[model samples]
Target: MQRKWMFTFILLVVGFMVAVQYNTVQQPSERDTRDIWAIRNELAKERKLHSELLTEVRALDETLDKYNASEEGNKGQALLETVEDLRQQAGITEQSGPGIVIDVVPSQESVAMGTPLHEISPELLTRFVNEVNRFKGLDMDIDGKRVTALSAIRDINGQTTVNGLPVTIPPFQIKILSPDIEKSEKLYNFLQSSSILDDFYLDDFILEINEPENNVKINGRSDQSENRYLKELPKGG
Candidate 1:
């Protein structure tokens, strides 16, 4: 009887140890599963928050656009007008109006064989450009190259150049733009009446002028440097 009781106690203790070991292993697996579930829940919450924030941002952008179109309309319009003026002044935009087109060509009959080919003088070209500017011409283009305020016309290596580019040989077009038909006509008359044409003819350069038309286009823009320098004025002197 004593032996049997000892064996039974030993079995009971072993069973209790096995149960404790099994529970210990199961507890860790359960805790790990719970941890994974908690992380998934947190990630879902963060994703939801991000989606809500994006929705709010979109709503705010829509509201701001509406405000800009309504309450801030005049300011927007003024800003647009300012931008348009700048574009016009910069010649970055294509302009079309009544203007004149002049073509300068070599008069073959006026020049004799074996004589030097009649070359257009850079000085004459410069003078003509200056005169047009003085007359408040809106735009000018030589051989499709835009003539800006800082354009340079000079003779380089026996070739007449405009802004450092050689104009193609004879019959190059010079486009001049004006604001209206009256101004265009006035400019055309000025060119015809001026002595410049007579001087050109004397030099074997044939200058041809087109009648003032309503659809002249000035499509070239300036590519000059954009750097500027300024000096501060004296305080009181």
Candidate 2:
């Protein structure tokens, strides 16, 4: 009887020890999962806050526009306005307007609307735009209108490919204003000599401009130029 009682005690002790170990193992596992979930939640909240800050910074771009009214800025704005006016007179679509928009196409015809010789590369176009942008109020566009295009010319990739679809080209549309064709032509020659037009070897690009009008609009909108916000308020801010 004593032996049987002792045996029963040993079995009970073994079962209790197992139960304790199992419970202890489960507790740590549950705590680990909870800790991981908490960490992820905190990270998500931080990411949302970071995105909000970025949006706030971009909103300041319009409010901080203050350089468009300077003397140098006015000249650029003037040049661009002339281009647009000339383009309108020439009957080219809005795509062909003032400031500069060069589109290069690969073609044998001097006047042929040819293929894009080089594939579009974002970096290449960006450099070209930056070079042109240094001119006070110079504006740019591609295919259509622009508030401001990160790429005056665009492509899907970072590099240009020959077999790729017709990519960025120039005079894609250009409009300029001059007292006469001579003056407008002079501007075109200046652009070439300045090496501003040296990036792409496009084909059959045409330039059009109209005679200058003194009362013409100078600055079309605020975002067209690097210096677009400083114009004197027209009686009101």
Candidate 3:
């Protein structure tokens, strides 16, 4: 009986030691897992913070560039250039450049008929304007009236009107300003060539082209309306 009781006490002691060893090993594993998880969370946060900082740095750089461009001396020049460009495009300022003047008159043969050739058709005039525009001709005028992109060309009561002005005369003056002299000469030749002249019955019309030695003056219009859909682009776009 005494031996049995001692053996039972020994077994209880061994069981308690095993349990303590198992608990010690498992506790360290759990703690190690928790530490790795915390480290991963810290790295993720740092990555997010780095991305945010990069975005802010780029924005600040753009702001600095804009500020430098808008400095006192540079600002005035930049604004002047921008305004001049806009004025030129809008035809709000007089331009002096190398260009051509064309005088169109009704041929005697067509005038004898006195039906279709009494006055030039608005369709033909519009086609001519479109061709000149295609060749990058700037600051156009028809019979002393400014021709703009917004100008209306339509027939009214057996007569053609440009921007609501009468153009029923036998001879019409068309003035065009080109940026280059060579281009103006090319356009003049093209207008007289068979490819363009033969497109219509221009044989019933007399077209005379002349290029001035000095600069040709072109007038501007004050009635241009502002665009409604013009908007600035967003930053970084």
Best by lDDT: 1
- Pairwise TM-score winner, candidates 1 and 2: 1
**TM-score of each model, paired residue for residue:** 0.59, 0.30, 0.57
**Candidate 1, poorest ten consecutive residues by summed lDDT:** 110-119
Provide the RMSD of all predictions against the true structure, rounded to 1 decimal.
27.4, 17.4, 21.6
> Lowest-scoring 10 consecutive residues by lDDT in candidate 2?
213-222
lDDT of 3 by residue, 1-237 (tens): 999999999999999999999999877655545587799999998997798799879966865575577978787676676668667777777777888888777776777878465666788778878877757446788877678888888987777888777775668777888878888888777777735454445647776677543477767764555679988899989
Put the candidates in lDDT order, highest first.
Answer: 1, 3, 2
Query: What does candidate 1 score in Cα RMSD to the true structure?
Result: 27.4
Backbone clashes in model 3? 0
Candidate 3: regions farther than 4 A off? 1-70, 73-77, 111-117, 156-158, 199-203, 226-237
Cα error of candidate 2 at position 204, Å = 11
RMSD of 3: 21.6
**What would the TM-score be for candidate 3 when compared with the true structure?**
0.57
Residue 213 displacement in candidate 3 (angstroms): 4.0
Per-residue alpha-carbon lDDT of candidate 2 for residues 65-100, written as tens digits (9 for 90 to 100)? 523443775766755765676544332433222332
